[model samples]
Target: MSLNYPAEGRNYIMDAAIHGGQQIGTWYVALYEGDYTPQEDDTAANIGARATEITAYTELTRPELVESAATGGASDNTGNLAQFTLSAPKTVRGFAVVSSAGKGTNTGKLLAYQRLATPRAYAAGDVVKVPVSLILSNPA
Candidate 1:
């Protein structure tokens, strides 16, 4: 899934790039099962407030995002797909990238989110793999 970096995310890039803000050492991907729509104003806390994060997974924790170098103005975790083995039945609607490594924690920046083209219902033991990307480009 491709990312749509929210306002906070945009600012984070600018800050880390030019304003001396601390660069995030690592970012994590979290899955959500709530009925929620991503907005430009959404933050990590905002997402946590509106969405029900899916934490019943067999994985030890949320997957860490390892991005490739940007080419053609895009970078992605294609080589390192986030894999989740569901421990319980759930319908997953979307995912978000956050600064925190702790599952269900809201304290951090919300980098981006993408609601799936279609929500997927998964049974326990089903594996879900996600590859995420970020693209930066000038407006045409």
Candidate 2:
């Protein structure tokens, strides 16, 4: 899936890249369930309010993102998949990477988000697997 980096994400990248702002060492992945569409101004709080977070899983507290090296200006967690074992059935619409590790908490910078091309419904014991990625390129 394609990822959309919000304003907060862009600024965070710039600050860590050029400025002296502290770089984020780890980011947590969260699954969202709703009809919410990600916007440029979307934040952690905004998303938490707009969508329902799927927290009925067992695995990493919040799936830690492990990305591959950037090649051709793109990096992804292809081999390092985030697997969530659902304790209850839910329809997952999308996912977001944030700075917070608490489930359903609205206290962190929303790094990136992307709605799934097709929503997926899971059974009570289903496992949801996702491979998150990001692409950086100059404007044409």
Candidate 3:
């Protein structure tokens, strides 16, 4: 998974992928801490012993660096499954971010995670809710 937080921005962009390590889960499950994956890079491990050492140093344990908030006004993805960086880092198997309406017609409405979901409203102090449990992946 990768998160793209543009500099000088107030909205954070996030992306995540599932490998072969994730377990089956139900809906509406929230992932907590202590489920992070701490594995070294695969390529580094294949390049002999010395390369493995270097790769270990460059390994990324958590996906926090990818989360960022855009500035000059926030970005909104209303009625859609928007990708927002997780401020509290944890490498789970699977997760999703849900948002409640900030104002206007969508105020206080429950938005499900679907393609129809879009970031329609962007604002400061907006709440980002991660309502799924994250599966921790093992090292390759």
- TM-score for all models, in order of appearance: 0.93, 0.93, 0.16
- What are the lDDT scores of the predictions, listed in order? 0.87, 0.87, 0.23
> What's the residue-level lDDT of 38 in candidate 2?
88
**Cα RMSD (angstroms) for every candidate in the order listed:** 1.4, 1.3, 19.1
> What is the per-residue lDDT of model 3 for residues 22-106, given as tens digits with 9 covering 90 to 100?
2212112122222222222211112122111111111132112122243343322232332333333233232222122111112
Of the pair 1 and 3, which is ahead by lDDT? 1
The clash count of every prediction, one per candidate, is 0, 0, 27
Per-residue accuracy of model 1 over 1-140 as CA lDDT, tens digit each = 45778899999999998999999989899998998878889888888768789999987778898889889998889898888899999999999889988878888899888888789999999998877887888988
List candidate 1 segments past 4 Å from native: none
Q: Model 2 segments beyond 4 Å from truth?
A: none
| lDDT score for candidate 2 against the true structure | 0.87
Residue 24, candidate 3: how far off, in angstroms? 14
Candidate 1 vs. true structure, TM-score: 0.93
